[model samples]
Target: MIKSGETNSRSFPGITISTDLVITGGGLSGVCCAITAARQGMKVVLVQDRPVLGGNSSSEVRLWILGATSHMGNNNRWAREGGLVDEILVENTWRNPEGNPVIFDMVLLDKVKKEPNITLLLNTAVYAVEKKDAATIRSLKAFCSQNQKEYILTAPLFCDASGDGVVGFLSGAAFRMGAESRDEFDEKFAPSATYGELLGHTLYFYSKDTGKPVTFIPPEFALKDITKIPRFKTFNAKDFGCRLWWVEYGGRLDTVHDTEEIKWELWKVIYGVWDYIKNSGNFPEADTLTLEWVGAIPGKRESRRFEGDYIMRQQDIIEQRTHEDAVAFGGWSVDLHPADGVFSEKPGCNQWHSKGIYQVPYRSLYSRNISNLFLAGRIISASHVAFASTRVMATAAYVSQAVGVAAAICKEERLLPADIIHEGYIGALQQRLLKTGQYIPGLVLEDKQDLVQLATIAASSELVLTGFPGKPLLKPLTLSVAQMLPLPEGAVAPVVFHAEATADTTLQLELRISSKPGNYTPDVTLATRTIPLHPGRNCITLQFDAVLEKAGYAFITFIKNPLVALHFTEKRVTGILSVFNSVNKAVSNYGKQTPPEDIGMEAFEFWCPQRRPEGHNIDLKYQQGIRLFQAESIRNGTDRPAGQPNAWVADWNDPQPALTLTWQQPQLISYIDLVMDTDFDHPMESVLMSHPESVMPFCIRHYRIKDAAGNVLAEKRNNYQTHNRLEFATPVTTDTLIIEVEHPSEQVPAALFAVRCY
Candidate 1:
């Protein structure tokens, strides 16, 4: 624990709050710093120049989060970050409803707001840093536009997450920019010598079709033959011209010295080129299509990288080298833009380093000279050549996550970023990462027993009812049956699965999976399917002739089929109305009453066969009526009055109801996997579904889970945040199960598509 005096020292504003550490920049790296520090119970003040979170990927830039994690291997770094980052992903799933950027802003804002230890000052710029001596920074001053005020921050530790390593430069910490000569780092891919010029920036844009088609007109500065460039084959106009070659660095003048001029000229070229393409008869189909996106600001790739304890080089990446302190993974090939401008005949190009993936040492991501600070993201300590490969957002995200964990440890140990890295904290970092759901295929564990156990063991909560042992298999087994059965309404039948032997070395085992439920004794109405299962590894999918619903119940029990798992628990899960409490209220927004016209209910009905409010002392009817009345108010986008309390107007309400009727014994409780029908909030492109505890790191560390009987079933500690769909391997045995949500004190109730439990 930190000394009481130190806590008091950093609490006051304008007092130059001193701490064990300070992180500058609110981008991915800075965000990770605050999250990691907060998890370790450290007080951190995250300063960002913009009003919003997520620098380049934010709606401010409107760039998609590009990375291997978003593409495949749900086990990407975000899964391991497991706290705020995960929350953002979950929220994205909700807001986007379609896995888009609509909810991205909210996700970023929510992450910063939910942390008590993190004081996020938005719309603020760090002007300069105060140095006590040559090595230590005494205070940092920031200008806050909202308050028209200035705040000076002080801390023992500081991280340069500004992408440009602003704090490091200001503090006199050794750093480098541009590509280093091959001989400097002995990296084969590096240029012979280093220069100031580095990879340029890009302005990303996105557009959608309105009811009417829009045409384009060329600007005066348009380049007539941009497409004539040699790299035209790889350039895809439809894909939004993301390839770097499309956005030429500099043709008329030096790009390094004239970035602003270059950016302005490029915009003109972009519009001009689009106009010509749209107007020309060569592409008649694209006439109706116009510029969907025009980036507000350009995304910069290379910048000043802070000097760290260890510098990762291009050789390390190509060799697929492993590090004892490996914290992040990089898979994207190394891409380098030529220093010289691209000519009309041949544009600049990049090369692929390797087909496989490699690990980035955590030591290279923190400051070498600065004792208190740690860095993550693109500004990590790496030569320009190596940064070219690691600069991708996905790789940056993983690096940021690792830094967050390391920063948290620094706070816990009351040490600087430099001290922590040298103290062998890498093992703890790896352990924390795995617990949070991050998949590092090449991650090596320090504990022999733990490493061996993790390698051989396979676990799935879905196998609880079937009695599958949570142990490794020495030899594969398989079982087969020749019976067939049909499935129940909105339900899949239980297939008594077994493990049988296999002769082929590669063929592990065969497990028979029934496609349907049997209604009568030996009613051979459905066909059985076989799936191969690999003991202690691999995802098993049971194939059948029937078109199975992932959202429907996976029957594993016999007495009465209960949902084994909530399939289709994708971004959106469908939910139904169930009432047991009275609720009613008038909803108003901005001190004005919102009419029903503002919010229209497509479906609302009370369906319960025999149950009534008076019977069972349930008051179901009264509760439902109240809920119905308030549901209408939400449609109008109004908030319920402060005095009104009985209504449970869940945000998961939909204009169109899917299933509604009386609750029965074998209740047809089918989920809809609700998705956002449209993007109502402009920037929120979509709402992401997130479990509140998972949205913020501190929530996970301090949260406790309880059963319906008020007994604490489990307490999850450690952060694992991501928005991927959570699949249950086993089904729930209860006839009816109610999921209770306990949100963090600082966070809002997370929006959800549906609550799915079969």
Candidate 2:
């Protein structure tokens, strides 16, 4: 046990504890950071000021968990923040579909608590720090308001994930506050001149109907005149909780120091808004509604951003620049809110999107002045314009995961945060991250330690026939539209699609190949087929003897037939393309409240009314719309990519598919990691929708591994895990390893993503 005032002077009364890593803040980023480090065998001490784990996502503040996927509304197709963030999302989606903030807090708390090496201190605020030298933080002093006790935590490495970067500030680390001038970083999105204004803070409230008429009495602190607020016109009393994100304030003042003042102002606005809803004769529907909950603490957006080796700028996000030392990626648009926030006359914010997702380098995650101080979340080095995109809770969680993994490597090698970037350790770090399911765009997992990469791969079935059990079109299209299906350069089989009809109908299907590369529009009709469809599902086969000269899209257009309903999958396929030619000017409300912005400007016009791009392979799902096959899934190292399908599938007739890895020479290996495809049909955001099962039925249920001599090395029967790691008690030396996969009794083909050995 740590004795009181042992490490520090008697003036500082606290229990002194030593750990390898010390993390401040219990937000999503901090929680993920501590969990990642602890899981990697590092002793972690997590100090969170709030009792709950999630900061903005906590019930205290009540913000939904959003990341790079942007609710799957943006054009950063198939982009989702992976690793720990994905884990939390998947778990939360399965456990709490209501999107309850209290359940989300438990999910985060449970994840951190499961790590044996993590010591979580809740309601503990880090107020003081001791410096080992000019460049290193030696220890931190925190006081837990809940327990009325103090703690002195000494660590070799320190991570400041605090939204306000309190640790870095107290440690005298170089930092910047507020916006920078456009000339400073050459950022076009930056303000014309420097300003101290920030993105402001938000307070949310939840309301419910009380069955009978409910009366609301206004508090004395509430604002009297609601007409002063410009956004008051958009206010609908029926919209409660997070839907009122525009109920924000304090961007014109200091976001951190002036938090109390901001909170008071926000309270006045919230109460006034509620009063208008209850007392105003305009809202008759609110007569039976009562305020269920209102947040006291405001969810802050920006404050003190620390200075690091590399300062991310708006150009990097706009250009979608790739960095050599990229450890994480962000796909959210350059979402910059006006300084006036709710009071602004203009729209709440202006968003500029990139062509695709952008990379975040390791150089921007460590303090420039304080060598041992690693930064995560909003504290990372970035100009205000760049921070606008990376400030979301999900993006911050990804950043923290990277920092946690990097910190583990640093502790293992006894190196500082900067050494990982300069000493050529980034490649290893990236590889490790990939193995853990973190998707870094453009960075393929090519670990030299992976024995499968050294081997010549052969499968029981090499030819992947397209258009089997085609994706079901949730919303059938009646207009004469074409769907683009990506065919591999070398073609071996014809495409088939399954469709249904309300009545006996005849439809004409035309297959058109692209005239130019990267173009999905049909240029010339290669083949045409006129077929009659039945009432229920029927497989329509089109036999076209044509070899795709290059990797391009095949546009399949179906003539308008009111009785015929074509099938398609919401899950996007890597090379599949979908487009529709419709003159209907009716706007599409494809689940998202806002339009696709500039990201989907063109694609929206092509596939308007439905909004989703056409290109997903035509594959029929199981009884309840469960996807069964994924192409190009093997060797990708990731099973799912947001709403995209990413697993390889075999011909359903191929009962026992064997994936063989034959190396040139016999190698000693002790560990193997295997990842399989779980259906991506289930939506991650299932607040209004719920899925029956978390694991897809198409997952491999049974598998066995054997050596060249046909000796059974290891086997798993009746397995349901998507990710399986096998560790041999003793090293196995073999030139050839065979992994024979058995499909479940459901008749689905086996799908695998990665076969890694170490």
Candidate 3:
């Protein structure tokens, strides 16, 4: 009915189009892939079978976008997914704090639409694939039911982000469905024997209070008795949205072929459950509640996992293995659910947490059989045990960004996906990703375009003893408050404290070591220091003669003094904490508590209870100029290494911090790239918790460049965002270059990730 063409044509019944990259499935992963590729100047076709984007995260399914943070539970600290995914989370937080699914849809749609090189094809399903050979795909045939038209799209590269691995399935890419035997991948957590069963699918519903009584009429398909359901005992009428992930089915059957049947079964369960809550006389609270929204499409958990060059195993995650070609990282626990889903009598799911974050290699992103086929989302190469953690939407989105960036590099270099590593292009891809704000653990950006790298580092002042201060010094306490400080295992060193007094006062400090880090009070007092404080700021030093046998907390406390106050800041560090206690109680046991009036109940708690903040470091070091030179920042790269600080911090007092470069011989430069810190300490998550700053206030708001003679070379004012690349109209030859930066706010230190010149 249609003739083949290069662009959309109405002459034929069907439409034909072409692009450099064809991304199937409009889920978070696919959307990120398309955006990343398009932003890099590649023409991209983003095809989604549904009317909207966000896949499970859309209003249709309403699943929260969870990544490494894992709902802020477990011990996965500071593990939020960065890059394009962070942008979406931040924008959603700013626009929709109530976690409204409708607004989230707009955020994703707006992001894709803003890309000039991206051609969005919503409600278009790619059903057929045209393969050039056994390893290459030539084109794809997609049918858009909404428009009642078919589209034949051709592209050099294809990414199958479809949750079901539809593209890879049609292309005959080798893939595994369901679980694999433990012997297959030597994964200890995997089942002893292989099974065709999968995690399952789920449908969610939202309910709201109408203020007045509401009646519910059951449909013919709804179940009459709720007693048949095993989970009814735990069900509550108030549970809705993602809180009801337990209402699931279809794990025992084919997730794709049996989708309709699964949806019908889930529908019955949802209505039946609603009926029980409304008319069953069991829940009186539901009389004033009504159903607001329900999902028509089931949110699938597992389907076909395509085969790639490397198959990620559970050991890689549990052991925290690092790969040389790792492109992304994931920290979600290995969460596996029974194939029987909600029907099973056992607990819904089992979770195994990792020691920390784990790495995902690039080799696991592209197909091993279909050379030209790239995969993202839950379909990426991983054993079933490993997929449990990587299958999360946020992790999938991060993977998609990696694939998108790699695809752009492939197109630019005229190479295949596998050839990227073979030809040493992986570094370039990593650098580009870092510059674009994709955080790859253990990797650093080494940009050469930064002219500041040649400059001698100097600063007006440097805060050498910089650490997290738990909370601001707002109120003075007459009672002593003990704080817990975690220390590395080994011989203990003298701890220092920075304090100030309005008048001369006697201060007594004690260091007590606790065997358990969670203990609210220490059992043994290892050392003590009694010093007379001066009126102005003073540094008190305490020495401990004991050695810590293991990594534990050193409970330090300053005796009650109403006239003296300890300086504190709101800035939070990862492992430090400010502890608080009940004024009249002493902690009898570690985390256990006695009655409120009990005098022996010692409770050391966070400065702001249930909140996270940094500890105040008494030994603050001050230096003149930036701590690290421009060369260190540019050469070290922008990827913030885990457990290590990679950013160059300037003096907080320097109103106009600047970096200058001077050379004996003049050099020609035209391009300048700058990477600034965007408050990595704040974890960017979906809806419930979002960072307040879309653009960190500490970043340079205004800046200008000049030559040795003080002639303005280029200037930019009202700057925002973390990454900035400026191009000069003409190359300038100069022996000296000075970069002046105006802070967005006074007293806040400037943090530079990298600055490069070319």
Candidate 4:
């Protein structure tokens, strides 16, 4: 018989750790919980399995953050999720213009380091959970790389934010994995019976655009009837090679259970597919193509889910059940992969809703058997069908945020997992979510005196502004009648602010000065020269010497009235900017072959749809205008030039970056024009904020910038490489303004792009 182990003092021999909450798994869910808990004045300890903070969405998986609000909506920003998610987006958009993975790691590290309330332990793995009693887990044993020793973390509350639900499994919390038969939960998507069958896995890779001849080949495992099995036809590579490849199998096989085995299959398929294309002569450019990424770590879509008080079933999602205890919402359809262990072209694999979003109750996130433990992410208690939809990372982030807040509430009230329902705390929890800037569709607000008071205070204290470069002034810059935003009450809110403000109202902002740290030279230094500021609305101007010998970027921060709006404008035609990522590795889009007459020129088109694309502007007044893609130089009129290759590249010289915009003049600065030029595609990266008038000249000192409605803007741009001049035309009236340039990239040169005010 296996006897229960005791937590001896020797377990935590040399650790000086302290925190009110300990969150495991630094993935989307874990990080969200950490950020939320830390913001609420709770000491937080966050642990992760990987070296980086983003788990499946990191370079490890190469998966982008997908959400319902992506590319559309008033907050059509890179990522609408706020707090930690927002922080990550801002860094990706500006600092890593090339979408460098290293930049993501650094950004996460910097944010965690800056927060005094957060204690981060990297390269750590949790091995065991020691509980003092059936209701409470006393400590957790973790192996750390830096110390090369084991340590125990003791906290009042614990969260299984790990996407794998490791803590729940180790703590003996009831959990389920794989598929459930259709009749089990009456889920239309469920299998005949809940079985251990799992979704197929993948190892995603990318190719650079290099104009060259390519040939296609057949796979060694080429089954003539492969498409008949439902997987082969998903990807359109007739020769079985050289395309967007996805090779998967039943992840439950023991012989193939090892991570290394899974990784091997992925690689084998990747090369096999390439070989087929090359041999078949179907992919002429495959010969010159470069692999930008091999298979990232195998991303397991569905796994063990911890059983909670209320299990989310397929019926809950299909019927769009509105639970009285709903704490979060998801709009994604019930997307389920084939269970037959092969890629299927079956028409009925995924499900979508026509109207309202699916609601997730609080009881579905915490363990019913464990009192002190709560779970989030894909592993939250849900039937197999439900897991398929909620498995996406964006949805996971919201769930994680909810977990963090609920944990805080549990600690403060000294309540058990079951007690939360009786206290009517779910509504309070929903309010906290709204305050954080995440949108939970169909959230019905319950009346709470304290919540109303807090919301009122937040609304009143917020700054609302108009025009770019809104800064403090020696006199009030009168707001033009056209520049004012429609306010509900007499109280105004800050429309767009630049910097993160401190308790004392100090603004902190970062500038991109150099690509590499060693580029620093004392002779060419940057010194801040501040301008005068007054009340109402004003602009602060900062002047510095642009004497850097090499190309790079820098950061700046200043105070301003919150009501003004500073629109950032860019005109880039052919290069990487802070905004966009190239679809392939080439600056220009080139197909392998074309008709004989159009031998060297490749035909392409560019469409912006409106004047200002969503997330391109903060005020939401302008949508992008459709423009045609015009090539300055081409080998031929309609075919790719013989030597011109297509590749995924990033250009940092584009006008758009993580720029903090404040109003310089309210009336004159009505609309902004952004233009760009790139070799392959146009990528623009910038942050847009809206706030009340009182919050002018968004503070830049504290490394935080928000819009008038408290929405935090975050962006991620991968299109890099290239050099081209871009232009931005923003109307301005007031004198003196603060413009903070934001650039996030590993290889940004000296300030080659500048702003010209007309």
Q: Which candidate is the best by lDDT?
A: 2
The numbered model that scores best in TM-score is 2
lDDT (Cα, tens digit) per residue for candidate 2, span 263-358: 999999999999988898889989899999999899999899999999998877866677999999886767777777787776676665554578
Candidate 2 lDDT for residue 597: 40
Give candidate 1's TM-score. 0.57
User: If both were scored by lDDT, which would come out higher, candidate 2 or candidate 4?
Assistant: 2
* TM-score, cand. 2: 0.80
Query: After superposition, which runs of candidate 4 have C-alpha atoms over 4 Å from their true positions?
Result: 1-18, 70-79, 96-99, 145-147, 192-196, 209-246, 251-258, 278-280, 340-351, 442-758
> TM-score, each model?
0.57, 0.80, 0.78, 0.56
After superposition on all CA atoms, how large is the RMSD of candidate 3?
8.2
Q: lDDT by residue for model 4 over 1-758, one digit each (tens)?
A: 88866765544335746568889988767777788788777788898867788776666665555443322211111223443454455445556645555555676667677778888888889989999898678888888876776768998788888877778888889988777666676655465423335665666666555566433344565343333444433443332211232355444543124656666666666665555444445555467665555655776666687888888886675456678877666644455555433444443243332122467788988888888888878888888778766777767777788877777777788776557787777777776665444445444223232111121111111111122222222221111111111112121222233222122232222222322321111112244433333323333332333344433222222223243333332322111112211121111111111213311111221111111331122111111211111111110111110011111112234343233333333323332211111111111211112111111011111212233444432221332222111222543343222222333322221121112222
**What's the true lDDT of residue 132 in model 3?**
91
Ranking by lDDT: 2, 3, 4, 1
Q: Candidate 1 on 1-758: residue-level lDDT in tens?
A: 77554343543245355665567788755776677667666778888888787776676665555443322211111112233344455456444544344357777778778888888878888889888877677878888877777788887667667776777777778887666766787766664322224676666555354556576657677767756445434433454534343465542343335668867866765665566556655665565566766766666677677788888877666556778777666755455665543333433544343323567887887677766557777888787777777886656766777766676676677666666556777677776654333435444223322211121111111001111122222221111112111122333433333232222122222212222221011212233443443433333333334444422221121111111111110011111111111111110011111223311111111111111111111101111111222222211211111111111222332222121111123322222111111111011212222222222311212233232354543333432322222233443222232223322222111222221222
Point out the worst 10-residue segment of candidate 1 by lDDT: 615-624
TM-score of 4: 0.56
